[model samples]
Target: MSASAGSPGGAARSLRSLRDLYDQAVELPAEERERFVAALESAGSSHCAQLRRLLAAADPSAESPLDDDPWARVEEEEGPEPVPERIGPYRILSE
Candidate 1:
């Protein structure tokens, strides 16, 4: 059956396990596969919280790399200002 269609009780949770799902997503590049796992874990409070926690542990920066990028580009174009603080668990502590 299709992955989505077959999601029975605890199935989504079981499927999110890296040990279980990683092989299925082998066609995905490493980075994308990691991100997909992250999203699933952050799906939260359910049975599959491990993936989200693993992603954070595996790559702290991956959680919000985009936030830093725009700020860096803005500075290169327009000079520096005080950086914003704390996007969730992250902090822009300096300019």
Candidate 2:
């Protein structure tokens, strides 16, 4: 897409505008961030697509890396689940 495909500004101008916009947003209090973003969207924010994705990624509630982790993410992604547990009357209790 052009720097400012939908607006009168050129691509380079749009990049600079978005850079400044993000910088401003990051400077606001965290509590006010959502309101700031909402105000932008209500005013037909042009950078909604990028803002939405960045916000999702920045959400603290989102999943995070674990400490003392031994396995790789690829390992979990590629590994198969354990087999279903089975029970019988004679099942041994010893560990």
Question: Estimated TM-score per prediction?
Answer: 0.26, 0.51
List the RMSD of every prediction in angstroms.
Answer: 14.7, 10.1
For model 2 the local lDDT of residue 92 reads 46
In lDDT terms, which candidate is top? 2
Q: What lDDT tens digits, residue by residue, belong to model 2 across residues 1-95? A: 65445576686677776777777777787788778788888999797667656666666677766533656665678796544444565554543
lDDT of 2 at 7: 77
Q: Model 1: runs farther than 4 Å from truth? A: 1-20, 45-95
Could you tell me how far off, in angstroms, the CA of residue 85 lies in candidate 1 after the best superposition?
Answer: 75
- Number of backbone collisions per candidate: 1, 1
Model 2 pairs whose backbones collide: 3-11
Clashes of 2: 1
- For model 1, give the 10-residue run with minimal summed lDDT: 45-54
